[model samples]
Target: MAAIIGHILPLALGVALSSVPIVVMVLILLSPRGRWSSLTYLIGAVIGLLGLTTLFSAIATLLPPAPPEAKSPLIGTIEMLIGVGLLVLAAIRWRRGRRHEHNPAAGTPKWMSKVSSLGPIPSLGLGFILMLRPKNLLFTLAAGVAIGATGATFAEAVVGIAVFVVLGISTIAAPIIFAVADPARMRRPLEGTREWIERNSSTVTTVVLLVLGTVVVGSGLAHY
Candidate 1:
C-alpha cells in the first residue's frame, strides 16, 4: 500500500497543481453567490476525480496479473504512453507560456468574465468539465493506473483511491475551505493568489509535468 501510494503521489500532485481550477475556485469564492457555488463546485470536482480514477483503476485491474517481482508489460506500456503524453503537454505549456508572457492582452478565459454570475449548478458543472480537460485527465489516468496495477485488496484500493482524490483536490479545496471559514480575511489573499497564478501558472505546471513525466517514465521502465 505504501509503495503504491508512493508511485501515485506525483500523479496526484500533477492533478492538484492544475492552475485553472484553482483560479476558477478563487473567482467563485469572490463571487456574491460564493458560498454555495464554491461548495458545489468543489463537490462536483471531487465526484469527477473519484469516478474517473476509479474507472481507470478498474480498467487496469482487467489486465493480466503478474507475480510480485515479475514485469507487467501491459502496465508498463500504459505508463510509458502516459509519461510521453505528459512530456508533450509540458512542451505545449512551455510554448504557450512564452506567448502569453509576451502578450499583455493574454488573460483569463472568456467564460470566466461571467463566473461571478454563475449559480451553484453551473459552477458544479464547470468544475466537472475542468477535470475532463486533457492535462487533468491524463494525470488522473496515471494515478488510476498506478493504483490498479498494484492488485491490492479491496480495502487497500479504497484507501489508495481516497488518498489520491484528496491530494488531487487539495489545492482547489483549500482556498474555498479557508474562504468559507473567514471570507473577509481571505479575500485579499485569494485575489493576490489568483493574479500570481494567472501570471505564472504555465511555468509552474510545465515544471511539474516535466518532473512527473520523467518519474513516471522511470517507473514504467522499471516494470520491464
Candidate 2:
C-alpha cells in the first residue's frame, strides 16, 4: 500500500501541474464580452473537456507500453521541451503585443469580430482544440506513461487520470461558465481582468512556461 501511494503521488502532481495551461486559457476565454449563460457554457465546456480527456485516455491505453528505462528520461526531456517552447512562444506573444500597443489596430484583427458568432459549440470546440496543442499532448502522454509504469493497476491509473483531468478542465470551465451566464454583470470586471492579462500575457505566459518546464525537467533529471 505504501509503495502504491508513493507511486501515485508524483503522477498526481505532474497531472495537476499540466492543467495550468488549461486554467490560463479559461481565464482568457472569460475575459471577453458576451451575453453570459453560465450554465450553458459550463455544461458545454465540461462536455468538451470530458470528451478530450476520454480521447487522451484512449490514446494512452493504445500506446505500446514503454520500457522502464525509457520512461524517466523521456518524460524529463518532454517536460524540458514543453517548458522551453512555452517560454519562446510567450516571448513572441509579448513582442507582438508591444508592436500592437504602438499601433492599436494591430491587435484587433477583423476575424476576432467573428469569434463572438461562434456560439457555445464552437467555443467549446475551441477549448478542446487548445488542449490538442503539441506541447500539451506531449506532457499529458509523458504523465500517463509515467503513472502507468509505476505498477498501479490499470484501473487505478485510469481513475487517477480521470480525477486529474476533470480538475484541470474545471479550472478552465469555471470562467467560461461565469462569462456565458452574466456577460453584462461580468463585463466590467472581466474586461478589466482581460485587459490586464492581455497587457501582461506574454510575460506571464513566459514565466509560467519556464517554471512548469523547469519542474518537469528537474523531476525527470532527478530520476537519472
Candidate 3:
C-alpha cells in the first residue's frame, strides 16, 4: 500500500494542480448561493473521481497477476501510452500559453461565465463534468492503474484510493474550506488567488504535465 501510495502521489499531484477546477470552485464559493453550491459541487467532484478511479482499479485487477519485480508488458504499454499522451498535452498547453500570453481574452473557459448563476444541482453536475476534462481524466486513470498494479488486499486498495481521492481534490476543496471557515475574511484573498491562478494556470499545468509525463514514462520503461 505504501508503494502504491508513493507511485500514485505524482498522479494525484497532477489532478490537484489543475487550476480550472480550483478556479471554478472559487467562483462557486463566491456566488450568491455560495455555500450550498460549493458543497454540492465538491460532492459531485468527489463522486466522479471516486467512481472512476474505483472502476479503473477493478478493471486492472482483472489483468493476469504478476510478481512485483517481473516485467508486465501490458501495463508497461498502457503506461507508455498515457505518458505519451500527457507529454503531447503538455506541448499543446505550452504553445497555447505562449500564444496567448499577451491576450487577456484567451484563457477562461466559456462555461465559467455561467458559474455564478449555477444552482446546487447544476454546480454538482458541473463538478462531475470537470473530472472528465482531459488532464484530470488522464491523471485519475494513471492513479487507478498504479493502485491496481500493486495487487494489494481489498483494505489496502481502499486506503490507497482514499489517499488518491483526497490529494486529487485538495486544491478544489481548499478554498471551500477556507471560505467556509471565515467567509468574511476569505472572500478577498480567495478572489485574488483565483485571478492569479487563472492567469498562470497554463504555465503551471504545462510544467506539471511535462514532469509527470517523464516520470511515468520512466516507470513504464522500468518494467522491461
Candidate 4:
C-alpha cells in the first residue's frame, strides 16, 4: 500500500498542475455573460478531462517505444512546443480582446457564445479539443509518460487524473460560488477581480506558460 501510494503521488501532482488551464477556462465561464450553474461546470469538467485522458491513452498505446537517445530531446521539444503554443494562444486572445474593446459590435462569435452558455460540458469539450492540439498534446503525453517511467502504475495515473479534474473544476467554481452566494458583499470585489483577470489574463498566462515550458525543456535536455 505504501509503495502504491508513493507511486501515485507524483502522477497526481502532474495531473493537478496540468489542469490549471482548465481551471482558468472555468473562471472565464463565470463571467456575466458566461455564468453557468456549478453542477453544469462540474459535469462538463469531468467529461472533458475523462475524454482527454482516454484520447491520450489511445494515442500513447500506438506510439513507438521511446528510444534511449530520443527521450531527453523529445521531452525538451515537447515543452518548448507547449510554451510556443501558449504564447500564440495568449497573443490571439489579447488581440481579440482589444478588437472587442475597439468595436463593441464585434463581439465573440455566436457559436462561441453559445458554447460558453452551455456551461461546463461544452467548455470541457472545448478543453479536450484544445488539449488535442499537436503541441499541447505532445507536452501532456510526454509528461504522462515521464510520470509512468518514474514508476507510476496505471491505477495511480488514473487517480492522479481524477484528482486533477476535480481540483481544476473546483478552482473555477469556488470563486463563482462565493460571488453569487453573497452578492451584496462580494459584488464590487468580484467585479473588480473579474475585470483585472480579463485585462491581464493573456499576459499572465503567456508568461507562466513560457516560464514552465522553458524549465521543462531545459530539464529534459539536461537529462539527455
Clashing pairs in 2: 36-180, 36-181, 36-183, 37-180, 37-181, 38-181
> Order of candidates by TM-score, top first?
1, 3, 2, 4
Taking all chains together, each candidate's TM-score versus the true structure is: 0.97, 0.64, 0.96, 0.58
Task: Report the Cα lDDT for candidate 1.
Answer: 0.89
For model 1, how does the per-residue alpha-carbon lDDT over 175-221 read when each residue is reduced to its tens digit? Answer: 88889989999999999998899878999999999999888888888
Q: For this target, which candidate reaches the highest TM-score against the unseen true structure?
A: 1
Over 1-224, each residue of candidate 3 has an lDDT whose tens digit, in order, gives 77798889999999999888888999989999998999999999999999989998888888766566758878887888889989999999999898888676775767798999999999999999998898877888888788886677999889989999999999888878878888899899888988898778889999999999999898888777
Q: Could you tell me the TM-score of candidate 2?
A: 0.64
Error of 1 at 188 (Å): 0.7
lDDT of 4 by residue, 39-152 (tens): 455455456555665555445444444555545455455445544554565466567557767787864345544543555555545654544544345344544444333344
Which lDDT values do the candidates have, in the order given? 0.89, 0.52, 0.88, 0.49
lDDT of 2 by residue, 1-224 (tens): 34334433443343334333333443445544333423334455455445554555555455454456645554455446655665565566567657877887665446444555555555555555556655455445545544454455667766756665666555445555676665567557655755665566555555555555565556557545
Off by over 4 Å in 3: none
lDDT leaderboard ranking? 1, 3, 2, 4
When 3 and 4 are scored with TM-score, the better candidate is 3
Residue 135 Cα positional deviation in candidate 2, in Å, after optimal superposition:
4.1
Runs of candidate 1 with Cα error greater than 4 angstroms are: none
Count backbone clashes in candidate 3.
Answer: 0
Query: Model 3 reaches what TM-score against the true structure?
Result: 0.96
Looking at model 2, how many pairs of residues clash?
6
